[model samples]
Target: MARLLLLGAGHAHMTVMAHLPEIISRGHTVTAVGPLSRHYYSGMGPGMLGGTYTPEDISFPVQQMIESRGGEFILDKAVRVDAKSKKVLLQSGREIEYDVCSFNTGSSVPQSIVNANATDVYSVKPIENLLAGRKRIQSLADRGKISIGVVGGGPAALEVAGNAAACAREAGCKNVSVRLYAGKVFLRHLSPRVRSLCASAMRKHAIQIIEGSYASGVATKKVTLEDGREFDEDVIFIAMGVRPSALIAESGLPVGNDGGLAVNRFLQCDEHPDIFGGGDCIWFKDQPLDKVGVYAVRQNPVLYHNLIARMEGGELQPFDPGGEYLLIFNTGGGTGVLHKAGISFGGRLAFFIKDYIDRKFMREFQP
Candidate 1:
């Protein structure tokens, strides 16, 4: 029997776990490793921070799903991949040998701009950090007025800033304020209309949007602009985009410019065919993909099929990124901005649509 080692309990890996019975029945032993037993759905993470959903509503019991399906689950972080020996090194000093391996390791926030002495600083990753930030905001607001600073110009930063304002409001703290350091232009990559809608939404929540400069450094309860101006904040959130897990590049494997595992159309490693990957952790050779959850969700079936085919000596299917995806930003106060195919709209109806879709997705994977 061949051994399959699955690294990280990400979106694509979750689908694999749902179909584990088929793989196990094929006489293949499966082993999954992750830093956390439960994987949080990043799509609804900002809503959870805004008190729109509970933690249990957006997280999946991945460890239970794997263990119940005759697969072994290890609650440990993967430190390295010894490709030559076909073994994975864990943070706990254990080595696992596998005939085949897959990575859904996900991405991480860049921390180079953060100072060592920074306090109350959080990253919009792992999804769980938002909960902690929400609690901190409530705590600080209980005493008096609190200033929260969010640094970044991307969609993640916008979501964080909007939800943070809602989090305080839900906690019954009216003295809370939010400032978004949106660099040169807010949502610069998006259409002008979408950017304007997002800015209006932020203004509706009394959030101050600061542009024309990016954050150069973050220190103790302070964010410094690139132009040498500093703003004091009770809490700070860094949402300056994400980078693929360093484990792939650190293991000396082939990587793209973004340091993600370089893979082909079949989602198989260019140099190591036995090594497959999806999600934000892989750099597609055919084209560059945005680091969005939609791509990860779309890769689920393709990865599941390819992994089984690789083991069974069957034909493998290539992955198609598909057309433009629908994006809905939940901008607090039961409001959202929906965009698809260059068409955009905003209102309560937009939020309702997003909420329905998000909840439906959770129900599909969460039993």
Candidate 2:
């Protein structure tokens, strides 16, 4: 029986966890190494920002799930991976020898945002911290005018700005403003019609959208843009992009230009054939796809196939992300945007659709 090691509890790793029993039944040993025992559903994070769900709704116990499937779960960060030697070393000083290794170490907040000294600014990648920001926001309730400035025009920024607006209204706050900043190219992955629909949705919800710009730096109750435009905001939400976590660099594995694990179409590193990576941690050699949870979710089946094939000495089939796929965004005022196949849909029904998709994704993968 071969021993297989899975790293990280990201979406793709969690998907493999569900099928772990089959691997064990076939006599292959299974073990998962992760820093946190809980995994977060990033797609549903916006819902939590809108106060539609709780922390429990978005988190799942990884350790319990792995054990239930007869796999050992190691709640420790993988510090180093010796692909040539087929061994991995954990932060807890444990060495794990494996026949095959798969990595799903997820991305983190972009360094551009994190390294900047932006007062009262927050990031969206670490949802747990955003939950704490909610409490700080609540404390400002009834204390006078408060405004939140959101940088980036992606779905996450839109979700944060929209949710903050809705939250301010819900908290009975008056004179609250939500401002969003976008680069020259906003929502470039989406079609023009869809972008226009989303913009209208934001405008209708009273979430101000400032396109073709960048926020230079932030101060308490103020934001200075690169173009000299200024905004008075009590808080700044940084929701632009994400970078692969530092654990990757620490692992001593080769990463791509995008700061993610370099992998081929089969999700295998060139120098480390046995070390496969998926989720946002991967930078596919051909075309670097957008960092979206939908892409990660779509990768589950292919990752499953490759992992199962490795156990049986079978060939792995590569999966390609299409040029365009469905893109959904919630505007935080109980409305959202759904763009698919060059069509756009929005409103309360769109929010319901978003909710259904998130709930279904979580339920199907429940450990």
On lDDT, the leading prediction is: 1
lDDT, candidate 2, residue 92? 88
Candidate 1 structure lDDT = 0.91
RMSD of each: 0.9, 2.3
lDDT of candidate model 2 versus the reference: 0.79
Task: Give the number of the best model, judged by TM-score.
Answer: 1
Q: On residues 67-143, what C-alpha lDDT tens digit does candidate 2 reach at each position?
A: 99999999898877777788888888999999888888888766353335545667787777667666666767688
Q: Model 1, 180-267: lDDT tens per residue? A: 9999989999999999999999999999999999899998789999999999998999999999999999999999989999999999
Q: TM-score of every model?
A: 0.98, 0.91
lDDT of each: 0.91, 0.79
